[model samples]
Target: MEILDHAFMQRALLAAVLVGITAPAVGIHLVQRRQALMGDGIGHVAMTGVGLGFLMSANPVWVAGAVSIAGAVLMELIRMYGRTRGDIALALLFYGGMAGGVLLTSLSPAGSNANLVSYLFGSLATVSEEDVVAICVLAAFVVAVSLGLRRQLFAVSQDEEFARVTGLPVRALNLLVAVTAAVTVTVAMRVVGLLLVSALMVVPVAAAQQLTRSFRATFAVAVLIGTAVSLGGTVTTYYQDVPPGATIVLLAIAVFVVFATLAAPLARRRARAAQAAQGAHDGVRPSPGTADDVKV
Candidate 1:
């Protein structure tokens, strides 16, 4: 109750829920495409954007959004033009983004670096009223672009070569994905910071994937998990005095482990049940571990 009594906490809570809903929309694409770390990379680029904004006396959030989108587009271009593939390229680009941010911050005022740690680890109490508005607008934009192009995005994400074969603009779809991911990262940075923004994007989806096979179900389940993590972490931080971003990420990891552990037994039970039903339909004996033999 004390938490909600403050305006910043209210904004932070709203921001958390929005991030919980939107981060995974982009993350599902990243996780399925084996590009989950892209959020971290873009986050580093966003840090550089923030640094640049500080140097120029501009709004860091806007600058970070612009720089992050540009960086995302640039990475796609490099991958397309250089014919590079795999994590190696992304890894290189990620390091470059971080190095660039460090360099930019070094060149800026001393105070810029002082505030950098907050961006790295997150301090939701510092999320201003204006930040909530920016985050809302960006998150909405990211989701709209993502879902509007879901068909083509899904096609490309599934198989780039196949999407190209079918006459889809694979390159453009890839760029769109990167751009949306960039937006997700920049907006999420305000809540979870650069270091753990990837977790906000990837972890819940990873947990949900363990529970559901269908994309829609996985997405829905992930939203629930993320929302819980956001609200839980924000509240937990009040008592623990820990960084809210770290709290959320650690909470997500715990949730992921719980889901993963549950998955194995559930999967085994489902397999047994399926086998038993097949045996029964064929007029054969059900297996020993079949659902017919075991309590539900």
Candidate 2:
């Protein structure tokens, strides 16, 4: 409570909440497509944007968003047309983006290793009002795309071939997803850092899956879990004087463990209940040779 008195703390917590909501919102689709690491690749690419911002004396968030979106679109193109060498292409992109960021940061007169380090691992105390505004706008876009077009995105994510056959623009949707993911990476960068943004995006969704059987349920629970951990971690950092990014990720993992541990027992109980229902539906049956013989 005392921590919230600071303007920086308020901004950090707000950013954390937005990250919590938006990361999992975009991530669930990636997980559905088995492209969970796409966020990581985009995060890597976003580094170039951050560096470019520093070099040009611009807002890193917007620059990172632009660069990451371009990178994501390129990745999608590779996925669509470069199947034979997609992994190789992706590796190159990831590495190039990171190297480019480092190079640009080194060249910037106003930027230093310390400046880069803050974005790399996050610095909650450094979040500015402009950053919160950027994050809010970006988060709104992420949520609208993720939830508004859920059916179309889900169809495309689950099966591209089938979705195309059903008259959906699969390629467009795929690109949209890539773009949204890129935006999410940027949204989370300030709170979780570029290096760890993927974890926040994917882990909360994974944690929710342990307890949910339906996609909607998973989405809802994941967002809830994400929010909980983000706020929890933000608060923890205030008291413990630790890195917010690491604390948030660790808390998410801890929630996943708790959910996984509970899943096994819940599964067994559901199985037993299903068996009982089946037995009741079948009605009581006589033993092999006991009941019918008595009548005779």
Candidate 3:
């Protein structure tokens, strides 16, 4: 409760809540579609923005917001143009952004290098009211877009070619997915920082998918897992004097491992029960009779 008394901590908590909600929501689709690496790529690109911010003497979050949007759009374009190996394109953009950011930061004054470290590791204690507001706004935007385009996004995620054949604007929706992921990465960066942000975005979603069937149920479960990690990490960091970002990432990984292990046994049990049901059914013979048999 004392953490709430401090304005900075309260801001961190608020921003974390927003990040927790949006990151896993978008991440569910990414993981389902096997685009987990794409989220990592986006987060790396965001780091380049962080470096650019330090170079420009502006807030890194603002730079991250702007550059990541462009990066996301570019990812879409590259995927469209390349037409086959989008993952390679994503990797290219990620490294290019990181290289550019590093170059910019190296050109900066010696004393400013420490600023980049904050971006690398994260400093929730340094989170400001403005940072909180920006994260909240971005998270809200991601949520609105996700909800508004849920059906189209779902169709696209399930099968892009099918969605396109069905007149679902697959290309535009794909771009929207990239952009949404970028925004989610930006928000996650604030809480978990760029390095571990990808884990925060992914692990919880993976955990949730283990327990759910339908898309809506998966989303709900993911949110719960993410929220738990965000809040638990906050408390752990406060009490244990650990790095908040790393703590949160580790928490998420722990959840993923626990759930994944549990799911294996559950899946085995289900398989066994299904096999038993089939065996029992196979033991029965159908009554052979014509439909018009007059016994009735």
The alpha-carbon lDDT assigned to residue 239 of candidate 2 equals 92
Clashing pairs in 2: none
Could you report the Cα RMSD, in angstroms, for every candidate shown? Answer: 2.1, 4.9, 6.3
List of clashing residue pairs for candidate 3? none
Top-lDDT candidate index: 2
Off by over 4 Å in 2: 283-296
| Residue-level lDDT tens digits of model 3 in 35-149 | 7867778877887787777778777787898898889889779877877887687778888988887777787654344466556666778788778878888898999988888
| Cα error of candidate 3 at position 64, Å | 1.1
> lDDT per prediction?
0.85, 0.91, 0.80
| Residue 247 Cα positional deviation in candidate 1, in Å, after optimal superposition | 0.3
Better of 2 and 3 by lDDT: 2
Q: Candidate 1: which stretches are off by over 4 Å?
A: 84-92, 110-113, 287-295
Candidate 3 steric clashes: 0
Q: Cα lDDT for residue 197, model 1? A: 91
Global lDDT of model 3: 0.80
lDDT of 1 at 64: 88
After superposition on all CA atoms, how large is the RMSD of candidate 1? 2.1
How many residue pairs clash in all the candidates, one count each?
0, 0, 0
Point to the candidate with the largest TM-score.
2
